[model samples]
Target: MKNAFVFLATGFEEIETLGTVDLLRRGGIHVTMVSIMDTCEVIGTHNISVNADSLFKDVDFSLADALIIPGGIPGSNHLNDYVPLKELILQKEKEGVILAAICAGPMVLGGLGLLNGKKATCFPFFEPTMTGATPTGNGVEQDGNIITCKGPGFVFDFGLLIVRNLRGEETVNEVAAAVLAPGY
Candidate 1:
């Protein structure tokens, strides 16, 4: 089974984080919600509290097929500022694991130079932060091992894209159809 880790920081966008988790779980992926904070309980930007599956320091991330980052104000910033997470991200990149981010979350990859020469997209205002990337402004953009999505509005598409990448187009179709998502 393919396993993925979704980082949850305090100020994360609830929909982008949880929606993607839901979609991936529906696609038969094992998704682990990881909290960057010291505690397992995380509070979103809108005051929604969620209990993460594990703390950042507790997991053996070697089993991760994909590392997902969801965007929101201080959440994205917190993700960017976490040294251990940044180190793991770089290591994952070297190992050719899939990396995905949405909205302001791509800035973390951009800041780390992972997006260099890659076509990526993020929430419009964060485009300038993607220093070495060519911002596509698309709802979703996938370049090799990296995938980026615009914002909360595209959470389903973003999640579906990750599913398509990790599984296959056939699985994407099945998941989409199961959810009654139009234009799949």
Candidate 2:
């Protein structure tokens, strides 16, 4: 089974974070929610609190097939400010592991220079933060091992794209159908 890790921080977008996780799980992907905060309980931007599967320091993300980041106010900033998570993200990119982000979360990747020469998209207002990437205003953009999208509205597409990349088209179709989503 494909293993994926989603990083959680305070103020993360509730829909973006949970929706992606739910879809990934439905696709039969093993997903671990890693909390960047000191505790496994994370508070979302909309005041929803979720208990993560593990703390960031307690997990070995090196074995993950993909790393996901959800975006929101200070959540993206929190993830960006955390030096260790930034380091691990860079390392994962260097290893060519799939990296996915939505909304402002892509700014974290862009800030780390991972989006250089890649086609990426983010919250429209945050395009300037995408550094060297060609900003596509699409709902989702998958450039090589990197996947980026605009916001919570595209969470399903983001999650489904991750499913498609880690599993296959057949699995994606099955999962989408099972979820009664727009089937491909």
Candidate 3:
């Protein structure tokens, strides 16, 4: 089974983060919720607390096929500030691993120069932060190994795209049908 790592820093968007995890899990993907913070309980922007499956330092990312980041205010900033996570992201990108982000999460990838020469999309206001990429206003945009979505409303598409990239179009179709959001 394809394994994915979803990083959760404090203040993450509860919908985008959990929705993606739920969707991917339904697709039969093994998703590990990783806390970039000191503890496994990371609080969301809306004050929802979620227990992560593992700490960032404890993960063996080398076995992961994809890396996901969900966006929310200070959460995105917090994710961008972590040196180890950034290094792992860069390494994953260089190795052609699927990198997915939504809302302000793409800004984190942008700051790392990973969006250079690619087409990306993020929460409307964050388009400017997408450094060297063409900022498309589409709800979701996938440029090679990188997949970006606009915001909470597009979380399903973002998750579906990630599934398509990792598993295939057929699996995405099956998963989408099961979720009643086929091609939405």
Residue 20 lDDT in candidate 2: 91
Per-residue alpha-carbon lDDT of model 2 for 13-120, expressed as tens digits? 989999999989988999999999999999999999999999999998768899998999899999989999999988888888899999999999999999999999
**Could you give candidate 1's per-residue lDDT for residues 1-184 as a string of tens digits?**
9999999999999999999999999999999999999999999999999999999999999988999999998999999999999999999999989899999999999999999999999999999989799999999999999999999999989999999988999999999999987678
RMSD of 2: 0.9
The whole-model C-alpha lDDT of candidate 2 against the native structure comes to 0.92
Give one clash count per candidate, in the order shown. 0, 0, 0
Number of the top-ranking candidate, with lDDT as the measure:
1
Model 1 residue 38 CA deviation (Å) reads 1.1
- Model 2 TM-score, all chains together: 0.97
Ranking by lDDT: 1, 3, 2
True-structure RMSD, every candidate: 0.7, 0.9, 0.9
Query: Against the true structure, what is each candidate's TM-score?
Result: 0.98, 0.97, 0.97
Number of clashes found in candidate 2: 0
lDDT (tens digit, per residue) of candidate 3 on 13-82: 9999999998899888999999999999999999999999999999899888999989998999999999
Model 2: residues with Cα > 4 Å off, grouped in runs: none
